[model samples]
Target: MDPASHPEQLSVVNEQVLNSADRSVTAAVCLRRFLCYGSESSTYSTKECPLGIENALSLMQLIEGGRGSEVVDEVRRFNLEGRAVRPNPGLFTLAVCSQHADCKTRQAALRALKELCRSPVQLFTFVQYKKELKEGSGMWGRALRRVVTDWYNGQDGISLAQAVTKCKHRAGWSHQDLLRLSHMKPANDNIALVCKYITKGWKGVEEAYAEKDKSEDLQKVFAYLEAVEKAKHSTDEQELIHLIEEQRLGKEQLLTNHLKSKEVWKALLKEMPVAVLLKHLGKLTANKVLIPGSPDIAAVCGRIQDETVLKKAKTQPFNILAASENYKRGHGKRSKLKWEPDRDLVQALDCAFCKSISTVEATGKRFLVAVDISSSLSSLCRGSSISTVAVAAAVCMIIAQTEPNAQIVVFSEGNLLPCTVSSDMTLMQVAGLLIQTPGGSTDCSLPITWASENEKTVDVFIILTNNQTNGRENPADTLKMYRQKSSVFSKLIVCGLIANNLSIADPEDCGMLDICGFDSQAVDVIHNFALDIF
Candidate 1:
C-alpha cells in the first residue's frame, strides 16, 4: 500500500518512536485532521472544525523525522485547497519547501511555486527569496533550476524574462540559473535578447545577433527600446499628445496599453483636456488603473457630468473591492496615497443601485439593512485592505441612497442597535461609525429577531456577513420563526463577503437569496428579489 494512503500507519509509527510524548500526540492529531478534513467524505458540517491554511501549515511543522511521504501528503492537501477554495497559500508552501529535505515534498513545493508565480507580484516575491539562497546550495539550487526548466519548456518566455528582470532590479542579485536556462531555449529570440542584455550588456546583444546572422534586425529592436526610453522621459503634455496620435494610428485601442507608468497616468489626468480625457475615462475606471486620492482622479471626477460617464463610473466600487482584495493576496500592493472617499465615486456607487432600481418600476418598498459587526469580520476580507465590516457599511450606504425608506442596524452577539445612517452622511463618516462599533461573537439571527420583536414590517432584509455564524440560532431558523410570528412576508437576502462553497440559504426556499462578494451585479440581484421578478 502507498504510504500516503495510510496516515494512521505513519501516526502509529511516530507514536511508538516518540514513546507517547505529548508533541507526538499533537502531531498525530494534526496530521489526522488534515487528511480527514481534505478528504471528499468530510462535509465540514460544523463551523468549528473547518480546515484552513493555518491548519495545513501547523501540521507540516509538527511532523518530524523520515516521514517524507506523510509530509508530502499534507503538502498535497494544502496544494489542492489553495487551487480550489482557499485564498493564496503560497507563502506557507514556500516556507515548508524551503525547510524540508524530502524529494517528494520538494516536488509538491515546485508545483505550488508554479501556481504562485502565475501572479506577477508573487513571482517578484519568489525571486527575492531565491536571491537569499547561498551559492550552489543543493536544495534551493535544485528547486530553482526545476522552476526555470519548466518555464523554458512551457514556452513562457515573457513571464520568465519578467521574473528575471524584477528579481535583478528589486533583489539586487544576478540569477545565473535563469541566465543559463535562457540559453537552453535559444529559439525564443525576445527572451534571448532580454537575457543577453541583463547578463552582459548591449555588446552581448551584438555578439548574439552576429552568431545567429540576424544582425540586420538589431537596429529595429534598438529603435523600439529607444522609443520606450523616450516615452518614459517625456512630459505629461507630450505623452498625452503622443498617446492621442497613437490612438489615431490604432483606431482607438485601449489607452492603458500606452500609459503603462502610474506617474504618467496621473500626469495625463491633470493636464489633458476634459473632453479628450472623458473619452478614455470609462475604460480607465473599468480597469481600476486610477489611483485613489490622486489629483488626476479628482479632476476626472469633476469633469464627469455626462450620464453615460456616471453609468460607467457606477461599477467603480466593485472594481475597488476586487483590486483591494488582490492587493491583500500579495498579488499587488496598495498605493501609499491616503484613501479619501471621492464624492463623485460615492455618487457613482449610488447610481449603480439607482440604475438597477430603474430596470423595474419603483415599488417604494421599505428596506432594512443589517450589517454584521462580529469579531470574525474584523479579519481582512480575503487579504483585502478593507475589513468585512467596512464592505458591509458600504453596502448599507448604497441602500440608504437608493431607498428613501431604508433603515440601518448593526448587530453582534445577539445584540442589535440602530445605526446613524442618513442620506447626508458622507462615505467616510459611515465607514468610521461602522468600523468603530465594538464586536463580539457572530449572531446572524439577531437582526431578524429584533425586527420581529419590534413589530416592524420591511419588504426586504439585507444581511451582510462572511457567513461563519456561531450564533445560538441559525439565520434560516430565525427567519422561519420571524415569518411565523409576523404577518408580513419579507424576503431575506444574505450577501456573503467571502467566497466559500457553504451557503446559509435554504435551497428549497425561493424567498431566501444568497449572493457572494462585492459583485457589481449584487445590486441587481437585491433589486430583482424586492420586485419578486426573479
Candidate 2:
C-alpha cells in the first residue's frame, strides 16, 4: 500500500512505521557520529561500526524529510556524545527527549547511552543508582536500563526472559548479560563492542534494534550462526548453501516483525491463572513498571497479546523515562489498611521476634499473628487475588507452627472464623470463605483500635498497609483516632506496605516503623529491621 494513496491518516500511519533503517536504528546514529567526529574512541564513548554509519544516515534522511530544525534541541538535550553520571539519568533523559522533538531525541539518546557502553566502572555506577532509576521512572527507563545495565556489566546486553525465548533453554548468560543485550551499545570491539557494535558486526544493521523477545531471539539467532560456522568443517558445498539459506531466513525472522514467542507469552500469562489478559495485562505492567505511550497505548498494550502488534509496539521503543505504572499503587491512602502485601506478610512471620534467619525450625512459641477477612484479602473476590489470599493465610499458618497455642481469626465478607493455632495445622481453611458483597468501607483506625483495645496479650501490635485509606481522608484525624486508642496501650508496630512511591514529608513521620516495596522479601525485611514481635 502506497502511503501517498491514503486519503486520511497518512501522517498517523507513517508515525507508526519505524524509520526505514529497521531494527538497527540505534546503532546507525552512533556510527554516523564517526563522520562528524572522525574517530571511534572507547573512552570518549563514540564508537560506531560501518553498518551503524549506514543506518544512521537513513534515520537522518527520514527526520530531514520532515523538519530538520526540530532535531537541534534533541542534540542539545541528550548529550549525544556526553555521559549521564547522575543518580537519575532516566528523569533527565525523558525530560530532554520528549520535548526535543520525536525521532530526533530518540536517535540522540541512543547515541548518548552507547558511548558509555564499554566501561566496567560506568556499569557499576548504574547498579549504584538503581534506586533512582526505578523510583520516579516509567516503562522507558525499564527498557533502557534492561539493556544498558547489561552492557556496562560486560553482559550480552539483553534481558533474561529474552534470553530464555531466544535460546529455547537457559544458556550460560547471567542476569546482567541479558540486560546488556536488551539495549544498543557504541564501543567498536568484539569482546567489549557493546550492543551497537555487535549488532552491526554480525547483522549489517546500522541502527539499534529492540526485539520483543530480545533475550531469546538473539540467542536463537546467535546459536544458528555458531552452528553454521562449525558446519563449514563437515558440511559439503550443497549442504553449506542450504545451511546459509536457512540461517539467512532464520535471521530475517529473528529480526523482523514477529514479537515474543507465543510459548513465552502464554507462560507469562499462565502466572495469573484465573485472570484473563484484560486483567493481568494491567497487573503485569503495574508490577513490571511498564507504561504505554498514552492512556490508549497503556490500554492497548495491556490487552493485546498479538506478537505482530506487540512487535510494532516493541519498535515504537518504550522510553523508560515516562511515568511508571507503579506511581499510584498505594499512593497515600489506598493500601493503608491493616494487612501486609505478600512479601511483608512473609517477613513478619519468617523472623521469630529476632533480626535473624527463621526457617521451619524457628524456635518455639510464635509471638505474632496477622488476620484479615477472606473478602479483604482473597483474589476470588474484588480488588484482591488468590495469590494474596494465599499469602495472608500463610502468615497465620506460620504463627500456628511456632506458637502452637496462637489465636487466629479469619474473616470473610461478614462472618469471622476464629481458630486455635497449633503446629499440626498451619494453613488456614479460609478458602471456602471467598465471596462478593457490598464492598465494605475500611478505616485505618478501626482494626488497630480494636486490636489495641482487645488484644492485651499481644506483645506488639503489627499492622500492614498499602499506605492508603478507604474512607479516612484526613490523615490527622485518622492518626488521632489511633493515638487516643494507643494512649492507654503501649506496644504497637505500624508497618506500611509501600506498593509504589510513598513520599513521607517527614523522615520521622508518626507511626512509620518501616516501608516495604511490594516484592520486598517480607520475612527478610522484617528480620533485617529487628522489628519482629515474638
Candidate 3:
C-alpha cells in the first residue's frame, strides 16, 4: 500500500517534509504568501496570513542561527528591484526579520533599514510593522535607536525635507515620536531644520533658526521646503499650480482640494510615474485633463508606451490590462466617476500591456497550456475584478502569442477540450470568454493523460489553476506515467491563481515549478523554466 495515496499519511509526510526542510525551502514557502497577498490591515487583529508570518519569523531565526542574511537580502531585492505589485508586504516581513528579531548584533536589520527604506512612506510602513509587533516593548532600545537614527542621517538635506512633508503620521506613530525616542541629533543645520519641521512644522523652523544662523549659501536648500509650507495654506489655484510646476511638488504633497483642479493634474502629469498615470486614467479623463486630440492625450499615450518608463516603474501587464478593462466600461468600478475613454489612449494601453509583459527567447519547445475551469477559479481575485479564470485565459493567450508550438485548452472533471482562440482578440475579451466557461470540478491530470493517450509531443505543460482538484487521478503520478508512455521528458508549470499553500508540483521534480500568482514576473519564470534556464 502506498502511504502517499492516503490523506492522513500524506498529511503526516508533508508535515515531516516541512519540518526537516532547510532554510531555502522554508524561506520560499514563508515568503510566497507575502509575495502574493499583501500585509493585513491594521484595523483587524488577526493577520492576513498568520501562518506565513509565523513561518517568516521562524525562517528568520533559522537563518540568523547560521549567521546568514539571506532573508534580509531577499526582502531587500523584492522591495527595491523586483516588479512587485505591492512593497508593503515585503516591508512588513523585513521589519519582522530585521527590528523585532535579531542575531548577535543588529547588522542585518540595520542594513535593511538603510537600504530598503528609500522613501518616507516605506519607512513609515516599516516602523508601523515594528510597532504592531512589539507594541513599544524595546521600541527605545539601543539597537532600534541606532536603526532609526541612521535612517534619518542617511538622506541628503533637500531630499530629507521633501520626504518629511510627504506623510505626517501613520500607524499611530509620527516622525516626531520616532525622532524624540531615538534622540537623533541632526547631522547639520539643514538636517536640523528638516527635523524641526517634522516635529513642529514651519513655525518650528522659524523659531529655532534666525535668518543669519546659516552659512550664506547653505540656506538655499530649504527654499523648496519653504514653498511647500506656503503651498499648504494657499487657496489660490493658480498659485498652487505655480508652486507644483516650479518646485516639482509630488502628488502626495498636494492638498485634497488642489487635486480637483485640472491644471494642477496637468502640471503633475509632467512628472507622474507610469504606474501612477495608469491608476488615475479615469479621474484624469473625467477632469478633462486627458481628452481626445488634446496635448495631454498624446503625453499620456506616449508615457504608457514608453518602454523605458514602464521598465523603470516595473509596470506589470495585469495593471495595464486592469486599467484598460475598467476604463473601457465608461465608469469607475467602485466609484461614480465616468469618462469617455479615448480610442487612441485605450489602444496605447493595450499596446503597452503586451510590451510590458516579460518575455523569454523561444526554444521551439511544444507547449500545452491548460486552464482550470473549476468553480473556485470563477471567483474573483482578491482586490480586483479579474477572476482567476480570467488570469488563466490571459496567461494562455500570452503563451499562444509568444510560443510557436503552443496549444490552449480548458479542463474540467476528466475532460480536456481545446479552446478556440484568435490572434486579434483583446486580453479583456479572452478573459470574458474564459470567465463564462461552465464552472465544474477539475481533474488536473486530464491534460497529461489526454496528451499521453493521443501521443501529442509536449515539452512544457502550463496549468493555470487554484489547485483545488477533486479528481481521482493524482497529477504527479499521471505526469510520471505520461512521461513513461511518451518516452519523452516533459515539464509542468502550475500558475496558482490564489494565495494558498496547496501545490500539485512534485517536490522531487526539477522540471516542475509551482508559482504563485500569474503576473508578468511569473510569465518570465514560466518562459525561463520552459527553456531550462532554472
Give per-model TM-scores. Answer: 0.44, 0.32, 0.78
lDDT against the true structure, per candidate, is 0.53, 0.33, 0.68
Best by TM-score: 3
User: Which ten-residue region of model 3 has the weakest summed lDDT?
Assistant: 39-48
User: Candidate 1: which pairs clash?
Assistant: 328-383
Q: What is the C-alpha lDDT profile of model 3 across 1-534, one tens digit per residue?
A: 364554432331123222311111233443433433342110111124432455355445545565335555545544554423356666766666665344622477567768767876777777777777786576667777787888888877888877777777776777898899899988777777788888877787777665646764347556777789878888998888888888888888978888888888998999887878888998888888887999889988988998888878867676787787778778888799999988998899888877765432456899998887765566665435666766776777667776788888877776677876666777767776666455667778889888988889899998777765667887777887877778677887766666444467665454566665555445545654566433
**Steric clashes per prediction:** 1, 56, 0
Ranked candidates, highest TM-score first: 3, 1, 2
Worst 10 residues of 1 by lDDT: 39-48
Q: Which regions of candidate 2 fall more than 4 Å away from where they truly are?
A: 1-199, 203-367, 374-391, 398-407, 410-418, 421-428, 432-460, 463-534
Error of 1 at 2 (Å): 22
RMSD to the true structure for each prediction, in A, is: 13.2, 22.2, 7.7
Which digits, one per residue and each the tens of the lDDT, describe model 2 over residues 424-488? 43233532332224144433344444444554344333343334445443322433344455453
Residue 6, model 1, lDDT: 73
How far in Å is the alpha carbon of 483 misplaced in model 3?
A: 6.3
lDDT tens digits, residue span 1-534, model 1:
465777644453344222211112244433433343231221122122333444564445543455644554444544443221222233333545555667765566567566545543444445555444333454335556667545544434444443443344333434454546434444456656655666675566656664564443444444333333344345565654464343221212224445654444554554454335533443455345565676656655554433454444443343444433333233223333233344465454443333332222234788889877774556544323556765676677767766778889877886787987776665557777677466687777788888888988777888877666778887777887777677566778877677454466554454566655644445544664576432
Better of 2 and 3 by TM-score: 3
